[model samples]
Target: MRSGGLKRLGLVSGLLAGALALSACSTVGGDQPQQAGQDGGQNASLATKLIMGTPNPPPLSEPVDTQIKRDCPPVDVLDGAAAFRAYATPGSADPFDIRYQASIADTARECSSLGVEAAIRVGVTGRVILGPKGSPGSFRLPLRIAVVDEKGVPVYSRMHPIDVTVPAGQTQADFPHIEDGVVVPIPANRFRGWKIMVGYDPSGATQTRASRAR
Candidate 1:
């Protein structure tokens, strides 16, 4: 590669890194809804219709643009619950028994600010990497999307059951999940402190078949 090409590559990488640094919260992003707030089935584009792992949870769609919407809450991913690691063994760290690992790559949102209540649409994008013991097949990717006020008060939170499939001959792919119609009532003075949060929720993950190595 030429020096100019190298510089261009470096610049692109730097730009990408800088975008992910938008906040100390949200996007290592992954999750599940406990009680349904709104059925995303209609507006969910790639949830069950996508074509890529680095992009699917049975989820993930295209690469999400981290751009924020005006008059709307921003989407965020929790740092601690960013990635989901599944082991072939019940509770062992043996690398050979590793199944697959999934992570949140980006997030986006659209908020409705015209009425006394706000409706927000949140989307999460990510990928899955197959491990040594992992195979090309369907796997569960747990995720949780939550909402909170600016003061850190809980507004809406739920777990969403998401999954991704590893197609034949592919070691990995992309996934994108979008939840639509998250409505929150606006208070007096029109103070909007709502934020959409996304992350990996292991508690909602399906029980994996662990190896005897445990």
Candidate 2:
């Protein structure tokens, strides 16, 4: 009886030792620290393009839906908002924020080389959509549309304050903005390398004063 009891006690001790060793090996170190991601905080860049003159293509010849004609207009309406010439630094915003969204949907350029001047008429259209939290109200959208060279030097910049009126029970608005007769000098040649960049301008009188205090 004594010999049998000794054998059983030895077996139990060995099993406990093995279990403790396995636990120690699994958690050799404390909680592992999470490593930072490689990507720095960067927003997806806005769209850009070289302007080209192209008239609206001929409309579809066959359309027999009678209600479609009465319900929707054939073409989009454009507001007669003038684009100004100004220089202001671009600002960044959270893309995923449910505040507002604005973008330059289309641009067309008509280049002319008259007696001694080279100019172009740039047509810009911006669309605004209010998010879930946005309410119907009147707000001015500061659109910073500028032309930059290859080295990202601003050849021309204008802060067009677009007056947006979100109608009652509506969450979307569309308007066309134009900056006509923009003079693009030949000395700044490399026209293909030139880029038209458009983004929101977050600078204002209140913010300007606060920045100066700092």
Candidate 3:
């Protein structure tokens, strides 16, 4: 009789432990999907849309004549006037398509005593659409970009060459590229607007020039 009682007690304890474990597991499983959904929501809120357009014609007659210059004294031509003319050439047999998009947010770190440290996340994608209607192309084009302040002063600049190939007769070739984030130490003084520009050369031209706006 005593042996039977001890056996029964052990069996009951084991069953209770199993039940508790199963309950804990079910609770954890139920919460996982909710957590994932919350993460997705956060990501959506953080994403900002960026739109790109050429406010004016390219600076130079040819893409090769385009130039980017930096750190000039105030009142100097930040970007040379002729530079625009160089890039302002007739559209290609297959027009080149370029787009610039950026996500801007306040950085956690402050640059000056006034808390001026700000960071902007920028992404640039360029595509060489072949044909008159901007159909897809088989060649990849190299590109250059710059970040300018509201006064038309260039604060940061970088170049990236992307290679993409589309089969002939395709309507479009999409080369989605992301530009690295830009962190600018804010000046103590108030400032105007900030702008970003991206350019491409489908003809394999490599010349570039830039100037700072006064």
Candidate 4:
């Protein structure tokens, strides 16, 4: 009877020890820290791009005299017969806040009998916030400009990238303003009408939703 009791006591003690060892191993493994991610597992920053305008193309098959009259109208003709210019703005009064000034010149001297120059001026200005309404962080934005014909075809394009940072839970109302202009010269004796298109990367990565300067 005494020997049987001793064997039973030893088995019970051994089972308890094994259970404690397994629990300890599990606790250690479960508590191990994981590797940090690139963003430190934090939320990503907000990004956006400005939208540009559509391209205005020159009139086709119009008589030289008529084409000149329409493009280099007498109202804003810089030169009596050789050159003309105009201006346009591409943004409104909401979330998408920006403007642009552009110029187009008619360089044809033989077609108009008078030297004519056509120019379009655009003015672009705006502000953008990078972080969430309350939490702010680093961000990247891209801007682009393009020249298109009346048929909505791209003739010339240019892009510029900008990087910015904002403070946490603060509104970034003030931003860098853009006051850039483009000049296009029409070849001599050419009678073509053209339009300029300005656009920005809406995805904050690529250009989208191109708009025309008014």
Best by TM-score: 1
lDDT (10s digit) by residue, model 1, range 1-214:
0111111111121121111211223332222221011343222222122211111123223223322223456566676777777888878788788898786665555555535676667766566778898999988777888888878777888887676877899777556677875777765534366567788887766433232123
TM-score of 2: 0.47
**Model 4 poorest ten-residue lDDT run:** 24-33
Comparing 1 and 4 on lDDT, the stronger one = 1
Model 1: residues >4 Å from true position, as ranges? Answer: 1-69, 189-193, 206-214
Superposed by TM-score, candidate 3 places the C-alpha of residue 103 at a distance from the truth, in angstroms, of: 20
Q: How would the candidate models be sorted by TM-score, starting from the highest? A: 1, 2, 3, 4
TM-scores for all candidates? Answer: 0.63, 0.47, 0.37, 0.33
**Models sorted by lDDT, best on top:** 1, 2, 3, 4
Error of 2 at 142 (Å): 1.3
Write model 2 residue lDDT over 83-196, tens digit each, in one string.
211212234233433455544343333344542444544554444667544667765666655666667687777766667665788765555455654665644343546655
Clashes of each: 37, 0, 30, 52
Higher TM-score: candidate 2 or 4? Answer: 2
Residue 97's C-alpha lDDT in candidate 4?
33
Which candidate, 2 or 3, would have the higher TM-score against the true structure?
A: 2
RMSD of each: 11.7, 27.2, 24.6, 30.6
**How far out, in Å, is residue 123 in model 3?**
1.8
